[model samples]
Target chain A: MRFRRWILPGILVIALAITGVWGYNQYKIKKNYETTMQNSYQRMFYDLKDHVENVQVSLSKVLLADSQEQNVILLSQIMQQAYLAEEKLAQLPISHKDTAKTEKFLNQVSDYSYALASNVLEGSPMDQDQKDALLKLQNYTDYLSQELMGVHNKLTEGVFNIGEIKRKEKEDIENANDNMLNVRLVKLEDKMTKSPELIYDGPFSDQVLSGKAKGLGDKKVDIEEAKKIAQEFTGAENTESIEVIEEGEQMDKTAWIPSYTFSIPKESSPEDSPIYIGVSKTGGKVVWMENSRAVNKPKISVEQAIEKGQKYLVEKGYESMESNYSLQYDGLVLINFAYKQNDVTIYTDLIKVKVALDTGDIVGMDAAQYLKAHHDRNIRQPELTQSEARGKVKTDFDVDSARLAIIPKEGAKEYLCYEFKGTYQGGDFIVYVDAITGKEVKILKIIKDENGTLTF
Target chain B: MKKAVLILSMAMLVTLSATGYYLYINNQNQNNFSSTTEGINSVEVSNAEKNKDGVEESETVNATLAPKVLYWGSTGQDVKDVQWKLAQWDYYNGAVDGIYGTETYRAVRAFQSKNGLGVDGVVGPETAAALGLNFGPVDGGTQGAGTTAISRNDDIYLLARAVHAEARGEPYIGKVAVAAVILNRVENPSFPNTIASVIYQPLAFTAVADGQINLSPDADSLKAARDAINGWDPTYGCRYYWNPATSTSKWIWSRQVVIKYGKHWFGN
Candidate 1:
């Protein structure tokens, strides 16, 4: 009793209340963590369902499309959908071993569609076997979409329990979303593996594995020279007054370039916004530049904006650059251009030009990709004649125009191929027939999305 | 009734032990001179002094943290650590493979030559301190823990990632500028106070929207993040930056740009 003056019931009550409150606080923290984790899992499941639906819908659209442009668009949409679905699927409780086939299926869909779309973008035609494969893919996606929607419906109905699903995982029993997932996803993936094997020298091919910027040569320029090149590249009137901000051979160990960065003073507001330009140390060319300022008001149409962008490119000596696509974002219309050499388009040399709708002036232009990839490519003569290449395309393709073109293989290498633009099964496609082997190398289904013409 | 009394006594014992522990910690904190700078260790100092080989101990040791000097022909994590910091600052151009090769030695010499360390190409503790690697685990006591030092590991990682994503290809200073902007925004009234909040704010950074923020931070980005947190405001309180060459946001143009570092122009 001497240990506590208030060794009474009141003291005991106080201590008990404190412990109770502290315990409650701890419990609340635990609850919050659990709820947040479950919510994330729920959100991921919902997103996966949506992406799978999109993949199915895109496949269906591909089946419906009759134009090569629409096929290109559809395939890209499918690729994006497949990638998103794969990402969401990985975030779920399902084991990686259980989902490996599904993941590989998604990967191939994205990679194959991308290769095919690139083939078309370079003006190739799709063969019948590719179309057949696409049709088969469409069927499996249909099955997946419906099954995924059904599972989502069950999730909405509280048919699956999150806690129970986790508990079942301990016993190595299939639970949570596994049954609903494996039932359809595994079958769909299995079907995907049996489809026609597409062997193309796309960016993903092992043969195309190289990270070196082969186009960037040994010529080096100092900062002062780089600054001059920068001012001209940025179209700045005052060359000397433009502040040289930073100069370096490489930004980091991984980056492969020496460049000088410069700042251009604003006319009205010296500090309002900053404009910077990067001139490459090699070949004294502009590598990267950016100008950020809000547009005033919408005054110019997209047509005029395109014209202005092209005009700017032409004036800046981006000779033979053709406007390939346009994307509208915020208040600006960004036009993507590809360089053409000797009547054959080089898709690797891409430049983006952004035109403000309000002023019809070129507000943004990023030539980093172009400068890194562009070089005087000695495009080889195709081993196969246009007619011979056409013969190797999907036998059912209504072959249109075939031409000799060189396209980038894996961003590091170039391959000359015969580009054939045509339609198959009332759906438009471009299938590239390898110039050397007379084999159907790549196929593309084209579609036009909201922003502009894009290939997967 | 006996059980009730026993429970009460146990609770009393717990409360008394808690109070004693609290007081012990509080007393230990007050005993230290200050954490922001080095405090003279009063315990067994004469013995420490005797072991220094006639070298006098520096007064401010806690303020600076640097691992043991890494030398050429030495291959370990420490060498890779300093090499990364050097690479981030544009002093080193070779891969951070942890082997202190000739390139790494040259980089160490350059970094030392610039930082006023001995130009002998050896990465002594002094140079390591400049590189921001810790000499040892910093005490998180009640004394001033140094405002420049970050406490949370995740904050350092997030800040470093933001730097890498936002200014990966920019010059070393540009990476610093990007990190500084985040810190500056943390202080600015209009922006969020936390690094994660300021960085993840919708439309604040293009890297977040583009998912480039997920890229792992290189050594330079990590160092830039550390430098920014350590009160290195290379952007000088500028709140915004964008490459005028690629950004179509005419709205951002209205802000006054203080200066340009690398490809980015910092604006207020």
Candidate 2:
């Protein structure tokens, strides 16, 4: 009876020790995971704080800047900072619904700053309204930075836990919003939305962009119609070879306007990079297309490439198009064709055609600019004669040649000028001359690297 | 006049880039980087001449007589020289800073009126000539001119085409290896002395025999070609490559394998 009593108690003691070790290891693993998660949250918070601080500093610089050049730099900096802050904000593991307003506020700041910078660079002084808007933005950002700093300090002191808030957000967003950080951010966004309406011509102005492609007309295109537009653009019709799959949202955010994206295979194999073509649901206009497949051999000359590109443009209802410039890379030549309205070159309306040099196939095309800006333009007749414009060009340099071309000015301004392609000191340059004023406007030097040409 | 205009216009249209009737004008415009003070504040000639932003050209404000020219606020080392030269000539009695400030502007106007040139207060081709500076479009940030240079365009294209055909489906490194193999052969006296001779030698690359080599190449192939030319030999100077799946010759297997990159087994 004494031996049996000892056995039962001894077994109980061993079982308790085993449970103790297992529990300790489990606790250690969980603690490590929590620390890692907390570190990332702290990193993002610090990054947000730094960017917001930069935004404030750059904004103050903008107000104090006396020169337009300095002002442009400051504005560009503010834009970059705002964009970076918004990017970091997206990385947070907070509830999406709660952070939506905060994210929108950051997006506006980025968009607004970019538009202002673009305007300032164009020699247009910021008007009273723009100044007022910027002052408000600066003050608002100052407030945001101060509040973020408070949250960060509190987080580091263990007074508030960002990790806890994020974990709770996954379970219950309302419970997460009860946290001070979310409440404060939401309040800041609300205040920003209530600020004076920003109405201007800069690209970020939602009112101006309309998000609707102007050149596409008013035809409502369904999925089937969109497929036909894709077929016409890629010439991938009547073939079992090309697999067409519709994509809801695009991975690349280059295009300003949203469209119905379609992924179509260029070859029969499953592994090849498929051509991604975006067609606007309205009017069935082909906005953009990219073929990521590797081009083969250069069996055709550059002239053949241009000829093939031109033919494809004409077949797709692109009329009055003249090839602007061609850049050769790999086995393909990307030719930028701008729409010609009258004798004037409408540079704002541009379409890029990628022609394969091996077989002269149109592998890629991007018509976003063309679709957004194309319209019948009322071009004015120039006051100065072509000879008068020519006279203004440097007489010493080998003038090589000159032609009438309308190039974009700051923002949406367009100038009908004489474009002179000349060689000076053995380097090539293109100089633009305002036709009416007979004044030399801008000069761009073409840099020929061993790889290819880059102009500035 | 009409005949002269017609000829000039025709020449302009036909005068493409370095190559004729093929490439278009390069479109990489101004960087909009305004870190430093741009020289010359004078109603700077602008490409945005007229459209919607009614910020009229400052030069064109009052004087159709001044003509479009470079004036105040222009920033460059040349501008400093212009200032120093003008100050030395007693035409401009201002600080010899490169900036075309108000003082420089006044001096330029005074000098132009005194010299019987139009008193537009701007530097035109005539004023530039009077100043004795070679007034061609000289930019400070221009890429420095290179000497001893000539590129074989046909060679780059051929190499790119060959790489694209043989390994279009392969990884980027494998693609470079394909181009590097051709380059390695060109260096080896045992093979060929030039890229063209090695790639076109009879019974060599399989793509040449089939018409696959004639297919168009993509951007990656071109990048690979450029890299190969720039001396990036990822194959460590290997001489030959053959797919292990199809190599039937017993003699080819005798060479020591360098690397089995992607589908091809490379050897020297």
Candidate 3:
């Protein structure tokens, strides 16, 4: 009886304690959840709002701009911005059913904006239909911005409590990285290299040498046969002065790169002798050829020829050159020089040097092989003055700006040149003039409105 | 004295019985409430027992929560083609594995970033719906309600196809030209608000036209496209390419020439 009398009171006190603890936990959880939701909503809302505003600003510029090109660009911008904003908005797990209407409204804005931009990019003249669509889009974007602002205000005021849920959603997102749409493509290639093979079609019967033809190394070139092959390839008129030299002791392992020798009249000087050089990877036919005055002459000793060639290169303003050990072929000695110009180092392997037949003194050198193999290189140099070279430009163009830079030229090293930048009829152009000669060399223009622009 | 004792014991027993009855009724009510909360009906309990004849279906379901068909073979072409296609979406998911896995999915998600589509990893009906192309039936063993499971290699292939069609013959320089053009559009008074909108606003790229952008790309094209995204601009500063051989459009070529690449010349 005594125990029973006290048990009821103890039980009442325990129940009160349990109720208090449970109520406290509920309040804490509710607060945390609300905070999470608010944060997510704020982030998403702000992002969407910013995108919409950007579109609005861009579109406004185009709508008010005088240039038709600018308007077209703005139209594209409007669609892109609107679409991005809507996509982001859709990512949010909004419990508010009313937001569905907002989404539909955003879709409408997207359709309208895209249609207008597409027409503009296609160079279609803007008409009343486009203008009406654009104006409506602007108004719709304004409404969206205001709606997001209201949501932001409510969030700040602590009106909701679903933050924990939102946080969990974000966690799911991080877990589902595979769901990401940003695909980076990795290119896989064959580990080994393959040479391009072009089949050789025949040139058998009797024909005369007419057009350009190349020679293969060690794989002897029968001059009579080569003449016919050239004639068949180009269908050009005939030529005569063809000769075949004796096979040397060292046969090049590769049949592609061949060395050949031909003589001009004894009366022709090294610089005046008309020489033809051709290159072909195939044994029979040439793919590339060039005709130029011979730069090297028959010489005596290899050592004498190399020394003399070095002297000529030095006098021609080349400094700090690296030379290859002498390579003797037939009756001539070949020496190579790798020369440096400013920041660029040029490798000229075919500096075929020659010594005089009588005195054995160094006499001739060739840079033909090196020039044909090389391309204009990239190098650093001092800036040039565009102002001085501006006199050469035509008065028809309105020059906007001028700059000094290194301009690339074919068969030449990069040089400090004057670049004159200007606009003509709304087109951007850059005119390059040689700094030393004040000669107009190249004209490059930057095309505007190429990718199609996005507006409000 | 005996009468008084009996009266007290009876009163005690009556009180004890009343308390026991109250506790029993409360326990029964609690059990009912719990069953309601859990939504576990008696019929379901019977079904659960039957299913657990030997192996537990519940346990199996819990163990294999991940969806089947984890791999998506290349969506288009071969491995090389898939690599190129993925490159277009700006997702360098590595060499096309021809298997759909985490990398491919991540790449797909990233691609969706610039698109106005939901960034769900599964290429679901919504994504397929948005693509709006008549892609032949997917080759998975089963067609789930939402996303069809694809091999990683298949994803790579599909991605490659898209990249190739969108950006073949376009080197890093071409990519830069394309990027510059996009930027120019952004800065211009007219154009779309975001990059995604511009690329996907429909009928923009030739690849996107006639559903070619949905195909896979080869390895070479993929590398070229990637280099472009990395800021290689071969176009220098010119934009616009139209094949003189096939282009019927009259206005694109009318612009002044700014530069040339391969066979096409770009102008403003």
Best candidate, TM-score: 2
Give, for candidate 1 chain A, the lowest lDDT window spanning 10 residues.
Answer: A247-256
Kindly report, for each predicted structure in the order presented, the TM-score of its chain A compared with the true chain A: 0.55, 0.64, 0.29
**Per-residue error at A192 for model 1, in Å?**
34
Task: Report chain B TM per candidate.
Answer: 0.48, 0.44, 0.38
Per-prediction DockQ comes to 0.02, 0.01, 0.01
Show the lowest summed lDDT stretch of 10 residues, model 1 chain B.
B46-55
- What lDDT tens digits, residue by residue, belong to model 1 across residues B219-265? 66776675455334445356777898987655567666566676787
Please, what is the whole-model Cα lDDT of each candidate in the order they appear? 0.62, 0.62, 0.42
* Per-model TM against the reference: 0.42, 0.48, 0.24
Per-residue lDDT tens digits for candidate 1, residues A1-456, read 555645665666676667656555555554554455467567767887888888888888887787999999998998888866765665455543345556556655666778778777777867777777778777767776776777677778887634344435445543433665555555665665665444554443323322344455677888777767777666677676688764222232223334566777777777554676666556776655556565554688777888898889888878798775675544577777778898777767777777888888776666655766787877777788888777776577787777766655432556678888777665456677778767665565543223444322
Which ranges of candidate 3 are over 4 A from the true structure?
A1-12, A15-19, A65-73, A87-102, A143-456, B1-65, B68-268
DockQ top scorer: 1
Native-vs-model 2 lDDT?
0.62
For candidate 3, give the lDDT of residue B64: 10
Model 3 per-residue lDDT at B245? 70
